[model samples]
Structure formats: C-alpha cells, structure tokens
Target: LGVRNLIQGLGEALPFADDTFDRVTMGYALRHVADLHALFAEYRRVLKPGGEVLLLEITRPERALPRALLKFYMKGVVPAVTRLFRHSSEAQELMRYYWDTIEQCVPPSTILAAMAEAGLHQAQRRIVLGIFSEYCGAEAGTDR
Candidate 1:
C-alpha cells in the first residue's frame, strides 16, 4: 500500500502525461462524472498500451425487486447507519446524493459504448448481486 504519487486531479483533464500508468481505476465515482466519454478519454490517454481500466459503480438494476432492495439500502439503511454511527449529517447527505445519482445515471450499455468509443476494446460489464457493476476494459496492446 505504498503509493508514492497520488495527485489530486480531475478525471476530465488528468494531470499525468500520456501512457503514464498501466492501470486506472475509478470506484463508485462514475455516477458523479459529468461526462463519461471525457473521463474515459483521459483514462485511455494516461494508460500504457494494453493497460487495464476498472470501474466499480452502483448501477441501476433492470428488475423491480433488486432495484427496490437497492433503493431501500441506499435511501434508508445507509443514511440511518451513517447518522447513528458517524453522527454526521454531511455523511448522510453524501450517501443520499450517491443514491440520487445512481437512480438517475445512464444504463450500463451506454457506459460500455462510451468506453469503446474511447478506444477501450473488450469492454465488459460484470454485475454483482444485480446492482454492483464492475466494468472492465483495456487499451490495444502493441501485439494487436
């Protein structure tokens, strides 16, 4: 866990040079990105050839039961836990904000398309428990 360089930078305009990294990961922040394509572009730009990209996000499930359960957890349980343990209104508000964004976010297909358009081939979405989405893709390697 020794990360030497962790720069605070925007996803749309990453501060690193081209091909600076071999792997790029965005966790639970896809819903907050204003432009998915631009963010993916920056990710691709900074990644070395054949570099991996992993996006862990809260996706809206298609079915009724799963969606309902997710909503209940996000809107009800998360805030309650935060309010009780953390005793922070701001943390509760942040969780509420996360739920709102996930509720309104674009579908997984659209996000996959954006990754493809950004030159990330082999884009795939692996959903867990019907709600958690793990999006994985990679840049074309020199062998390709």
Candidate 2:
C-alpha cells in the first residue's frame, strides 16, 4: 500500500517516459476524462510492450428499473445519508456529481473502440452486477 512514486498527472498526457511501466491502472475515473482516445494513447505510450491496462468504472445500467434504482441510491440515498452523519454539503454534492457523471458517460462500446483505436490489442470490457465495468487491453507485442 506504500506507493512512494505516485505522481499526479493528466491521463491524456502522462508524465512518464515511453515504455516506463509494465502496467497501467485506473479506478472509477474514466467518466472524468476529457478524451478517451488521448487517455488510452497516453496509457499505451507509457506501458511496456505487451503490458496490460485495466480500468475500473461504474457504468450506468442499461435497463430503466436498474438505472432508476442506482440513481436513487447514488444521487438520493447516499447524499441524504452523508448529510445525516457528517452534515457536509460538499459530501452530498460530490455524490450527486458522481451520479451525474455516470449517467452522462459514454457507452461501453465507445470506450472499447477508443482503446482499440489507440493501438491497444484485445480491448474488451467485463461487466459485473450490470453496473461495474472492467476494461482491459494489452500493448501490442509479446511480453518482455
């Protein structure tokens, strides 16, 4: 858990040398990226040949019932609960923003296509619980 070399930088323009990392990972931040193509290109640039990329995202459910339920939980229940315990408007607003992003995010097909367009091989998404999406791809080469 002690990640000493963590550097805060933009996903579209990574602050690292080419082929510097064997793997790249992001969690619950895909919806915040301004450009999926640029982000995936940067990821590919930094990864060693055959290196893998994994992104964890909360995708909005496709069906109306599940989407409504998720929206109720994230946008309503979470904020309400946060206000009850913490009395912080910021926390409540953050949850609302989270739901908004998920609601407005592009579909899984578009994301996968972006990855493939960025030259990542075998791009695919795995869904869990109809809401959690795990996007994965590998740099185009044999493992070094």
Candidate 3:
C-alpha cells in the first residue's frame, strides 16, 4: 500500500478538476453521504468521459429471516460481544450506528437511477451473498 497523493475531500463536492480521473470508487460509505445526486454528479464531473464509477456497500438483506438475523447480530450480538471484551461504549454505539445506516440506506434501484440521472450510462448493481452490493456505472462517451 505505497499509495501517494491521497487528498481528503467531501464526496458531494469533490476537490478535483473536471474529467480528471478514469474511475471513481466508494466503499461502504454511501449511507453516510448527504445526497446521492450530488455525490454522483461530483463523481461524473471528475471522471473522464467513458470512465467508470464503482460503489461497494453492505445493503440490508431483502428476505425477512436474513434481515432479522443481521439486525440481531449487528444490534445485539455485536454490542454484547464488544462489551464482554471490555470495549468502550463508543465502540458499541458505533456498531449499532453501522447497522442503523444499513437498515436506512436507499434502495439499490434508487442508487442506479441516481447514477443514470447524473449522466452515467449502463448503471447497474450486483448483489453478493444477499447483502453486499456492487454498483457500477460509466461515463456517457469516450470522446468529450
């Protein structure tokens, strides 16, 4: 991981020049964003035409059983285990918050639509293990 040139910036207002990158990616942060439209617009603006965007997120399961199990694990078992291990209250709260965000995150369809509305093409989502979502979209054209 000898990466360099890491610049910290907001997702909705990326601090980059137009068409500067070939791809943009976000991992497990979609639920925390203030606005999907603005975030995707920023991604589109920073990407070179034909560039791609990828978002990796943990979505709540659609099935009731799996959803309930996940909720129990995240909200109950995780916090209980952390407390058993003598972790701080902040850590326990953080686990609950993580579950809350996933429970309240926008649907995959809405995310794809936002990508399309931001001018990206071929917007789609791939679900893994019934919970992990990989969202992908591409810039409209190869030529500016």
Q: Which is the leading candidate under lDDT?
A: 2
Range of the 10 consecutive residues with the lowest summed lDDT in candidate 1? 135-144
lDDT for every model? 0.90, 0.93, 0.92
User: What ranges in model 3 sit over 4 Å off?
Assistant: 142-144
lDDT of 1 by residue, 1-144 (tens): 899987898999999899989999989888888999999988999999989999999888888988898899999999999999999999999898878898997899999999999989899999888788999999986432
Candidate 2 TM-score over all chains jointly: 0.94
Question: TM-scores for all candidates?
Answer: 0.88, 0.94, 0.92
Q: Per-residue lDDT of 21-92 in model 3, one digit per residue for the tens?
A: 999999999988879999998899999978999999999998899999999999999999988896689989
User: Higher TM-score: candidate 2 or 3?
Assistant: 2
Write the candidate numbers in order of decreasing TM-score.
2, 3, 1
Each model's backbone clash number: 0, 0, 0
Global lDDT for candidate 2? 0.93
Would you give me the overall lDDT of model 3? 0.92
- Residue pairs in clash, model 3: none
On TM-score, the stronger of 1 and 3 is 3
